[model samples]
Target: MSKLPLEGYRVLEWGLWIAAPTASMMLGDLGADVIKIEHRVTGDPSRGLDAGYGSKTGRQSLYEGFNRNKRGITLDLSKPQAKTVISKLVQTADVFITNFRQSVADRSGLDYETLSKINPKLIYAVITGYGSKGPEADIRAFDGLAQGRSALAMQAIPEGPVWVRPALGDTVAGINAAFGIVTALLVRQRDGKGQKVETSLLSSLMFQQTSNLALHFIGSIPVAPIPRTRPTNVMLNMYRCADGKWINLYMPEADRFWPNFCKAMGIEHLRDDPRFKDIWVRAQNSEALVSVLDPIFASKPRHEWIRILKEHGCVIDIINDYADLPGDPQVIANNYLPEFDHPNYGRIKYPPMPVEFSATPGQLRRPAPEFGQHTEEVLLEVGFSWEEIAAFKEQKVI
Candidate 1:
C-alpha cells in the first residue's frame, strides 16, 4: 500500500470529548503520529460517557470511535513541570492542537503564542466554541449549544427551533479544524513559517449552512424558509409506503418529471389536474396534492415503488435510518463504513473519512489507546529518561 499523505508529521493534542482529539484523529488517519494528552484524574471525559446510556462498565465506544490511530498519555497541566514537558514536545512537533477555553489556555501557558515561541514552525490549532476574540470566547460550548447559536437548529426544524442530534456541530468543526491545519502546513512549506489556525463549532456550523445563508444575503430577498413537513415542491418530499417504510422523491423540475412520475405512480390522470397543474399550482396546493397521493403511495411497498419509479427514471430513494445504514448496498460498495476487529468490541465498524486519495489513502493504523497507555513510550521519544519519567509520575505531572 502507498504511504498516507501525512506521514512523517507529528501532532501533539490536548483535547477532551470531540473537537481537538477528532482533528488529531484525522491527521492520524492520514499517517501522522498523534500523541493525545489527557488529564491524569479522568483521562478523556468521553471515555466514560457511555455509562449514561446504561453501559455499566463505562464502555468507551464513543471515544474509541473518534480517536482511532493515535497514542495517548496522561498529564496534569496544573503542575509547573507539565509546561516543561509540553515545551519539549513542541520543539519537535509539527502541529499542536488544544480545545481549552481562552482563559484556561492563557493561564496554563498552552496558548498559541507561548507554544509557537518554542517552535516557530509549529502549526498551532485552537478549537473553540466561538472565535477567540469574541465576547463568548471564555464560555464553554458543546455540539448542541453551537448548533443553536449558529441557527443550524432553526434550519433543521424549519417549523420551530430544536437541536439536531448526533453531535453534528462537533463533527463538522473537527473536520474543518483538520482542513485548516493541513492548509496551514501547506502555507508553511511555501513561506518557511507556521501560523496559528483557529476554528470553532459556531464557525463550522455557520459554514455548513452556507447555502441557506446565501439565499438570505446574496439573494437580497426577504427570507421564507421551507418547512420539511410541508414542503412547497410536492415532488421534493418524503412519503410513507404501505409497509410502513418511507421514501423520498427529489424531482426538481415539476414540468419535466410530473408526467413520468404520475404515470409511474399510476396517477397519470392527475398530471393535468387543475389544482396540481404546474410548479406554481403545486406549491399552492401541495397539501391537497399530498392528501390525494398519500393513500396512493401507501398502496404499495417501498421496494415496489422504488422499482417502478426507477424504471420510469424518476429520482427517488428509500429514506434510510441509522439502523439501515451498515447493510446498505451503496455504503458497502463505497466502503463508507469499514469493519475492524477491535479488542473490546470484537468485529466493529467505523465510518471512514469522507475523502479518498488515489496514491495516499487514509488508514486505520491502530485502535484508540488506553488512558496513559503510551506515556512512558512517548515521553522517552521526547528525550525524557526513565528516571525523569518516574519522577514526573510521582509528581502527578506526566
Candidate 2:
C-alpha cells in the first residue's frame, strides 16, 4: 500500500461534542496528524456523554468514537502563557478546525484572520449551529435543535414533528465541514493562500433535504411527512411478512419491473389490469394495489419471499435492524465495520472511513488518546523544553 492521501498534513482541532471533531477525524483517517486541544480541567464535554438507549457501553464510547486517530493535549486558552503554544502550533499547522462561536473564537485568538497571519497556507474550518452571521449565530444549539429548525424533524415521523436519533444534523455538518476543508486545502495548493471555510448544522441539513425542498421551490408541491402506510408507489413500499418480519421493495421503474414483480408474487394477471397498468395508473390506484399485494406478501415468511423475489430479479430485501448489521455479508465483504484491538475495550468494532482508495487506502492506526495523554510529547515537538513544560503545568496553562 502507498502512503495515505493526507500523510504529510497537520491538523489542529479545538472542538467539542461531535461536529468539528468529526471533521478532523476524517482528515486523520486519511493520515493527517491531528492534534486535539481541550480545556485543561474539563476536556471535551462529550467524554461524559452517556450512551443511553440501554447500550452496554459507558460515557467514553462517544468520546472514543469521534476522537480516534488523533493526539490529545490540554490547555487553558484564557491563560497568557497558552498563547505561545497556540501560536507555535498555528505556525506549523496546515489546517485548523474549531466549532467555537465567533465570539469565543475571537476571544481565544483562534479566529481565521489571526491564525492566517501565523501560517498563510492554513486551511481554517469552522462549524456552527446557525451561521457565522445572523441574529442566532451565537446561540448554542445541539442535534435536536438543528433538526427542528431545519425542518428535518417535521419529516422524520408520520404523526408529528420529532428529531431523529443519533445526531443526524451534527454528523452531516461535520461531513460538510470536512469537504469544505479539503476543498480549501486544494485551493491553497494552487494559490498558496489560506481562507476561512464555514459550515452550519442548519445549512447542512437543508442541503440534505434539497430534493424534497425543490418540490416546493420549483413544482409548487408542499413537502410533507411521508406516510409509510399509504405509499404513492406500491412497488416501492414495505410489507409485513407472515413471520411478522418486514421486507422492502424498491422497483422504482414500475413498467420495467411490473411483469417480474407480479410473477414473483404469483399475481401475474395484475400486470395487464388497466387500473395498475403503468406507473401513473399504479400510483393513482396505489392503495387498491397495496390492498391486493399486501396479502400475497404476507402469505410467506420473510426468508421465503426474499428467495422468490431474488430468483425473479425483483429488487427486494428483508428490512434489517441495527443488530443485523454486524453479521451482514455485504457489510463484512465491504469492510464497512472493521474490528480493532483496543487497549481498554479489548476487541471492538467501529465504522471506518466510508470511501476506499485503490492506491492510498486509509487505516485506523491508533485509538483515541487519554486526557492530556500527549501534552508533554506534543510540547517537545513544538520546541518547548522540559523546564517550560513544567512551568506551564505549574501555572495550569498546559
Candidate 3:
C-alpha cells in the first residue's frame, strides 16, 4: 500500500474531550504521529464515559472511536518539569491542538502565543465553545449547549427546545477543526511558516444551520419551528407502514417525481386530482394529501413500499436505527463502516472517515491506547532518558 498522506507530520494534542481530540484523530487516521497528552490523575474524562460499543465490559468504545491511531501519555502539568516536556514536543511538532479554556490555558502556559514562541512553524489549533474573543468565550459548554444556542434544539422539536442526541455539535466542530488545521498546514507548506487555527462549537453549529439561517436572515423572514404534523414540502416527508416501520421520501423536485411517486404508491388517480394537481396545489393541500397517502403507505410493509418506490425511481430511504446500519448492504459494500479485530473486544466495526483518496488512503493504525500506555516510549522519543523518566514517574509527572 502507498504511504498515508500525512506520514511525516507530528501532532501534539492536549485535547480533553471530543472536539479537539477527534480533530487530532482525523489527522492520525491519515498517518500523523499524534501523541495525546492526558491528565496523569484521571487521563481523558472520555475514558470513563460509556463507549457504547464492543463487549459489555472493557475499554470505552466511544473513546476508542475518537482516539484510535494515536499514542497516549499522561502528564501532571502542575509540575514545572512537565513544561519542559511539552516544549520539547513542540520543537518538532507540526501541529499542536488544545481545547483548554482561555484562563486554564493561560495558567498552564499552553496558549498559542507560548507554544508558537517555542516553535514558529507549528500549526496551533484551538477549539472552544464560543469564539475566542466573545463575551461567552470563557463560559463552559458542551454539545447540547451549542445545539441549544444555535437554534438546532428549537428546530428539532417545535413544541419545546430539546437537546439533539449523538453530540452533533461536537462532531461537526471536530471536523471543522480538522479542516482548519489542514488548511493551515497547506499555508505552512507555501510560506514556510505556521499560524494559529481556531474553530468553536457555536460557530460550527451555525455553519451547519446556515441554510435555515440564510432564509431567516437574508430573506427577511423570521424562522418558525416546524410542527411534526406538517412538512414544508409534501414530497419530502416521513411516512409509516403497516408493519410500523417508517420510511422517508425525499423527492425535492416535486414536478418531476410526483406522477411516478403516485403511481408507485398505488395512488395514481390522485396525480390528476384537482386539489393535488401541481406542486403549489399539493403543498397547499399537504395535510389532505398526506391524509390520503398515509393510509396507502400504511397498507403495505416498509420493505414492499421500498421495493415499489425504488422500481419507480422515487428517492426514498428506510428509517434505520444504529443497529440496522451494521448489516446494511450499502454500508458494507461501500466500506463506509469498517471492521477490525480488537484483542480484548473480539471483532468490532466503526464508521470510517468518509473521504477517500485514490492513492495514500487512510487506515486505522491501532486501537485507542491504555491510559499512560506510551509514556515511556513517547518520553524516550522526546529525549528523556530512562533515569529521568523514572524520576518523573516518581514525581508524578510524565
The top-ranked prediction according to TM-score is 1
Q: Write model 1 residue lDDT over 1-398, tens digit each, in one string.
A: 67789999999998889989889999999999999999888788899888878887656888998899999999998999998888888998999998889788888888888988999999999889988886788899998999889988877555678888888988888999999999999999999898999999999999998888898899976555576445789899889999999999998887899988889988888889888889998888888888878898999999999999999999999899989998899998998888888887788888787888888898887899998999999999989999999999899897
Model 2, range 1-398, lDDT digits (tens) per residue? 68999999999999999999899999999999999999999999998766544565654888889999999999999999998999999988999999988889999988999988888888999999999787999989898999999998999667999989889888889999999999998998889889999999999999999998899788989778656566778878889999988999998887899888889888888889999888998877888888888888789899999999899898987788888888889988898888889999998888768877888998999999899999999999999999999999999998
State each model's CA lDDT, in order.
0.89, 0.90, 0.88
Which residue ranges in model 3 land beyond 4 Å of their true spot?
51-56
> Each prediction's TM-score against the native?
0.97, 0.94, 0.95
Q: Write the per-residue lDDT of candidate 3 for residues 301-345, one digit (tens) a residue.
A: 999999999999999999988878878899888888888787667
Best by lDDT: 2
Model 3 gets an lDDT of 0.88
Cα deviation of 302, candidate 1, in Å = 0.6
lDDT, residue 385, candidate 2: 97
Residue-pair clashes per candidate? 0, 1, 2
What TM-score, to 2 decimals, does candidate 3 have?
0.95
In model 3, how large is the Cα lDDT of residue 368?
Answer: 84
